[model samples]
Target chain A: MAVEITVKGEVMTALLSGEIDHHSAAGMREKIDSAIDSNMPSLLVLDFGGVSFMDSSGIGLVMGRYRTLQKLGANLHITGASPQIEKVMKLAGMNRLATIN
Target chain B: MKIVNKFNMSLYARSANEGFARSCISAFASQLDPTLEELNDIKTAVSEAVTNCIVHAYKEKLGKIYITAEIIEGGILRIKIRDTGCGIENIELALTPLYTTVGGERAGLGFAVMQSFMDSIKVSSKVGKGTTVTMKKKISPRITVNG
Candidate 1:
């Protein structure tokens, strides 16, 4: 998996691609958390448009980031999830933790 | 049910193998002519099961993960993932949604995801022996018009 981060004003967007599993998620989490720590943007957006596959590891990634951003007074926004990924996130109650689109 | 086709493989319990396992199972299941959604569901379920073996089963040590995929009668795909590592002490608690023994980035939703995607799932374990997760999903046969 790969993560590309961009910052615009107070918004930071992370564009993730490739299959996300336990192996790949560790790298993604470290990169995103480092960005969040340094930038501390008011909003963090996770773009899943390029992600072809994801399991519950994706949910843990989002939940962890949400918790980190929440402590920093930032909000998390998830977008571009496909139908299948969206279903997994919703089933895990991710909608209540972040803004999913 | 009669078995149409089947394959078995054994791999080391490592995180990197998670993707490899998913790809292998999905490729094997392709003979069923499952839809993209069905294929994705199978891949996701397989990932969760393998992840559990890697993350929880062999947490402190490395072991072997055995997998068997069989296409049975009626367009059903059955997958069994077995680990000879540390087995779960309580199967019921482990299957509960969001209940995880490990802390940090684990959401503990593996079993939940497996149950949601697969038509049926059976998990059996002995604390010292090992754990086995057998999941099955039925792929509806598609109709085609031949000219």
Candidate 2:
């Protein structure tokens, strides 16, 4: 339904879990935004270790983060996407937007 | 936890059907602990395909949307999304990467995204009957970084 993120020192790590769809977008957007606003980490890392499903609403989440960091001047990185999730990113031009580690 | 069993939903195939189906996914599949990225992938793929049906098939006419999901053998999740709308006239041409019926010079990545995001994708449609999109995903045995 949503994702969880942990801030470790200067690096904020998000442990994204569960299915993401339109319904969950608002909550996710708020949570991630809060994490960014509260932690103000220099490096933001999204760990997809627990993820099981993703959808277009996922794009809005990623893109929203990318834009947010752009304005704040922070480094963003993504990791642990499933193969199917990874392909969607590639097709959506995610590679060009942020580093997919 | 395992799939337990397949879940199914049927509703009037309207634009709202997209949001309804999407909400159901988040509700039913959250237990697997999908990452934010993973959720995004499924959402994008499903949205594109369902949107295609609403846009191309019904052409504003009311129809029906049927969806079935199963945590198949090997811990894989399989989803069958179907609509009673106009069927694809040419499967080959429609499946062609970067091909679309509208908006030229576009990336034409809707179908491409569906195929790319799902481990296995299947489709069935007949003229005047409508179309069905089958999508599958296999969760990794081990939950490593960036699942």
Among all candidates shown, the one with the greatest TM-score: 1
lDDT of 2: 0.72
Among all windows of 10 consecutive residues in model 1 chain A, the one with the lowest summed lDDT is A64-73
For model 1, residues B14-53, the per-residue Cα lDDT tens digits are: 8889999999999999999999999999999999999999
Q: Native-vs-model 1 lDDT?
A: 0.94
Superposed by TM-score, candidate 1 places the C-alpha of residue A4 at a distance from the truth, in angstroms, of 0.8
What are the per-residue Cα lDDT tens digits for candidate 1 across A10-73? 9999999988888899999999999998898999999999998889999999999988888888
Q: Can you list the residue pairs that collide in candidate 1?
A: none
TM-score of each: 0.98, 0.58
How do the residues B1-147 of candidate 2 rate in per-residue lDDT, one tens digit apiece?
Answer: 465678888877565567667668656555555666556556666777776776677876977778887776566777788888989889878888657676412245667777876687888889899899998876656457885
Which residue segments of model 1 deviate by more than 4 Å? B145-147
- Quick one: best lDDT, which candidate? 1
